[model samples]
Target: MTKDVIQTIKDRASVRAYKPKEVPEETLEKILEAAHLAPSAGNIQPWEFFVVKNQAKIEKLTEIAYGQEWMTQAPVVVVICTNPDLSAAKYGQRGEELYALQDTSAAIENMLLAAEGYDLGSCWVGAFDEQQVKEVLELPAELVPLAFVTIGYPEGDKEEVRPQKELDEVTTIIN
Candidate 1:
């Protein structure tokens, strides 16, 4: 990887606090473009993104997400949903059960990195009632809510957090 790419990865942190300023339409589109570039299994892209800009919906999402009030402060909440049926059209059970979610995860990571590149803060949120998210977003049954990415300018400094384990402890090499 390029040094800049490595630096970007190292600098990324999940930001929960944000400024009240709105994210510009062009910037948000760029982040979404990054997500669209993420790899998919068998080239089957099964993800759908819902860019939530409404305050009331964001507040409802905060309630649905166990009252993580920080979510309400974000200017944009990108709801990444996956369609298992779309994935399963080719890979069957494995596609439905695993690949769809796996692909969505890759997309989420891309979104985080892209936000970081633009000097915007981002947080990936998974703790929410899935059913409630679907109802609140008025999603089709085929689309299952996978994750939420909140985006905005950060309010203040984020304390650096040490990795739980050393790199050697987490890696295994056979070569």
Candidate 2:
């Protein structure tokens, strides 16, 4: 069997390098739509994506990400931020930390798959200074910076998928 959606899920990898070509606006719109359709806790959909295609904004984000210069080269940098006001009030502070991050992550994953399906490339960047990102994006005090996603055309052929440990190594059957 060659593979399918399940294989796509298993084969997905974080692509860091990208070609300098601009991604078409329509493709970006589809990726955003897929992200927006992601399921959320309490259907809050508290996530907001800042699609930064401007060179200046990309430069600012690159600086905020602490010299991750590759960020600026990508055609689009999507800053996934979460708004607390949209979240359920019952969960409290812990809710802010858990639900928002999880929801945004799911959205990001959906977007990455959408990109792959469209023959685009994307990477989820979570290692960054949150405060610097917030300041660069001019985010509201209530919005939390969760992750930065870089997307573009692949710079080179990704022929080899990373090796995976067999299921027996990590799974246990009980039923």
Best by TM-score: 1
Tell me how many residue pairs clash in candidate 2: 0
Model 2 misplaced regions, further than 4 Å: 1-4, 88-90
Please report, as a residue range, the 10-residue window in candidate 2 with the lowest summed lDDT.
Answer: 1-10
Check candidate 1 and list the clashing pairs.
none
* lDDT by residue (tens digit), candidate 2, 1-106: 2236676676667777888899999889988998999988888888999999999988888887888987877989999988866664746775577787778788
lDDT of 1 by residue, 1-175 (tens): 2227677788889998999999989889988998989999998988999999999999999999999998999989999999999889999999999999999899999999999888889999999999999999999988999999999999989847755688799899988
lDDT of 2 at 170: 98
Tell me how candidate 2 scores on lDDT: 0.83
Assess the local accuracy of residue 137 in candidate 1 as a C-alpha lDDT between 0 and 100.
Answer: 91
Cα error, residue 78 of model 1, in Å, equals: 0.7
Each prediction's TM-score against the native?
0.95, 0.88
**Global lDDT scores for all candidate models:** 0.91, 0.83
